[model samples]
Target: MATFDEINVDISVVLGSSEMPVHQLLRMGRGAVIDLDVREDEDVSIYANNTLVAKGQVVLLGERVGISITEVLMRSPEIRPMRTDGPL
Candidate 1:
């Protein structure tokens, strides 16, 4: 497992949606709204190595923002259901 300091986290923030690229992005100025892949009222998921690890609500941290972890999502082990039938 990698420690916090050992990882150069590439964080992604999803809040809305947009279909523009670099050329259009350059045209964006102050107050420009760029949509993301998420929606409002939906719990944002935190991913590590492309796997979900936690869920949280968005919070304002002065100039920047952060996720206030609401729930912790763990990687649950696979379960094979118990058999109830006997050999015939």
Candidate 2:
């Protein structure tokens, strides 16, 4: 059996998203700012192999940017339950 530590997965930290028309996208130029759905103080989503694994916040270290993991998520039934706050 192979060790889990030797396995590799695709990890991504999503900051935000935005929807725009093709015309509007084509009109974008250098220095353009397209607003995102995420707020400045919101925690970003962390995905591993396209699955939500954790949440984190953005931070700046000296001259580079990094994500500081705030919570470690699990994939249990209780954790994967549907939200009761209405449709996403």
Candidate 3:
């Protein structure tokens, strides 16, 4: 069996998103803030390897920041059936 260790997965936490024109995007410089569509209490989407896997909330621990997982997503029709011959 192949070992699960040493495998690297890309994790992405999306707090919010914004849309703007190309001209406005190009004109923005340093210290520019683009308002997002989400509020402070909204849950953030968590992606693993570019796939949406879970949802979480942004947390602050002292000076550092982290994410607290609130829910785990399961894909429909992807779950395998249980073995009928095995004693599971």
Q: Pick the candidate with the highest lDDT.
A: 2
Candidate 1 global lDDT = 0.73
Which residue pairs in candidate 1 collide?
Answer: 16-35, 16-36, 17-35, 17-36
> After superposition, which runs of candidate 2 have C-alpha atoms over 4 Å from their true positions?
1-6, 77-88
| Residue pairs in collision within model 2 | none
lDDT of 3 by residue, 22-84 (tens): 999999999999999999999999998888889999999999999999999987766535678
Return whichever of 2 and 3 wins on lDDT: 2
Candidate 2's residue-wise lDDT over 5-80, tens digit each?
Answer: 8999999999999999999999999999999997989999999989999999999999999999999888988757
What's the lDDT for residue 35 in model 2?
Answer: 98
What's the CA error at residue 41 for candidate 3, in Å? Answer: 0.4
Candidate 3 lDDT for residue 73: 93
Q: Write the per-residue lDDT of candidate 1 for residues 12-81, one digit (tens) a residue.
A: 6445456877899999999987777777778887775566677888888999988888888766466433
RMSD of each: 9.1, 8.5, 4.7
Model 3 segments more than 4 A misplaced: 79-88
Q: Of the candidates numbered 1 and 2, which has the greater lDDT value?
A: 2
Using Cα atoms with residue i matched to residue i, what is each candidate's TM-score against the true structure?
A: 0.51, 0.75, 0.81
Looking at model 3, the pairs that clash are none
Ranking by lDDT: 2, 3, 1
Report how far residue 65 has shifted in candidate 1, in Å: 0.7
